[model samples]
Target: MERELALEFARVTEAAALASARWVGKGDKEGADDAAVTAMRVMFDTVSVDGTVVIGEGEMDEAPMLYIGERVGIGVPPEVDIAVDPLEGTNLVAKGLNGAIAVLAASPRGSLLHAPDMYMDKIAVGAECRGRVHLEAPVKENLRQVAKALDKLISEVTVVILDRPRHQQLIEEVRQAGARIKLITDGDVSPGVAAAYQDSGVDILMGIGGAPEGVITAAALKCLGGDFQARLWPEDDTEIARCHEMGITNVNKIFTMDELAKSDDVIFVATGITDSFLLKGVRYFKRRAVTQTLVMRSTSGTIRHIEAHHDLDKKPLFKDHRIKLLGE
Candidate 1:
């Protein structure tokens, strides 16, 4: 993949975030998601790659666009596989809460795992702790490993987990292990990637999250030189069958960073739709909208933070959608 495509992906997520930010606090998650999906779909056409959606909105029958196997870009060179979450935390955006982002991961064809939409039990840590923790390890044991790798006391380690009933036991185990906890209501991708950045104040991320998100998170971690491990957690026969359809015969197999995002030639980009530990939410100004985005490439091992200001009247991005500005 060319380095120039990194900026193209930034524009894609930025458009999605700007479009969906208008729906914040409206109490309409579906509306916010639609705005994001439509904007992202439109932006992809402006890029110059022959892209296939391996992990996307949904199946062809479920989503109108950006669905699995859907083709994007200008039908050009650098064939790639795309995995996207146009609105990663629709509920967070609808409630005007934090931790919402529009994110995407792109890599060469056959470089990304075709993860089905289901639950995946994940454990992630920074580069320093890579090869130290394992998904099959007990929660306390993993925490202990992270603490030892980071040279922190057990009580100094901070683990982030999704706030859900399913995490009750996981949460308790972490507590018993004597690590601090940060619980989020929605969106685990941010924290999952944040674990790779020591300054992000997130030591590790644990618990189950969407499999599609796990792949996206894996791409970012691979770029950041972080360690991530996960196992598909299918809820029933239906989901298990879905995994098999994707050629995942070993349902209990643990996926490492390399397997999840096969190649180092991967690009991950995300734009914040709401304030969180990793990024700030979009801000509307007089005739301008400000967005903060993170663009990373595993090939170059570079992470770029982009802060773009869009001119409402001049930018072609907003013109195509003709979306009503939030403050206007």
Candidate 2:
């Protein structure tokens, strides 16, 4: 992918974030998500790549826009595969909570995993701990390695996990291991990538999240030279059958970062929808909106934190005005 494409992708996420930010604290999670999806779909039309949605809202039959296998962009050169979460945390936006984002990952054709929408067991850590931790290792063991890699005591290590009932045992194990825990109600993608930044206050990420998000996280971590490992967590025979239909014969196969992202030539972009550790939420003032975005590229190992101020009065998000910038 060309370097200029990263900025183009940033605009896509920014449009999604700006559109969704208007719905924050409105108790309308679906509305916020719809606003973001519509804005992202519209902005993608201006991009230069010929992109296919490898991971997105849903399959074509289930979603009206940005569905899996859907074609995006202007049908130009440098065909790529895309994975997007226009609104990563619908609940966070609805409650005006933190950690919501509009995130996407892109890579050369066939470079990204066509991850199915299902639960995935994941373990992520910063570059310092790369090759030091393993997903199959016990929670305590992995924590120990992270602490050792960072030259900190086990108790000083902080682990991030989604606050879900399914992680009860995993949470307990981390506590027993004497590591601090940061439990979030939704959106693991931010923390998963934050674990790669030294001062993000996140030492590691462990537990289950959406498989598609895991792939997106892998792409970001690849840019940071971090480590991410995952395995599909099929809950029942139906999920297993779905995996078979997707050509995944080994339901329990563990995926390394290389397997998930498949190439170093990947770009990951995110615009914050709500306040979080890595990026700030969209802030609106009058007819303008301010956005903070994180853009990363694996090939050059460059990470850019961008703060943009948009003149909403002059910025028409959609060609058809599908969503009002300030929810007007």
- For this target, which candidate reaches the highest lDDT against the unseen true structure? 2
Over 106-177, each residue of candidate 2 has an lDDT whose tens digit, in order, gives: 999998988888899999999999999999998889999999999999999999999999999999999999
Q: How far is candidate 2 from the true structure (C-alpha RMSD, Å)?
A: 1.9
Q: What's model 1's lDDT at 240?
A: 94
Which stretches of candidate 2 lie above 4 Å from their native place? 58-65, 318-320, 324-328
- lDDT to native, each model: 0.90, 0.91
> Would you list the clashing residue pairs of candidate 1?
none
Error of 1 at 316 (Å): 3.3
- In angstroms, give how far residue 137 of model 1 lies from its true place: 0.8
RMSD of 1: 2.0
Model 1, runs deviating above 4 Å: 58-65, 320-328
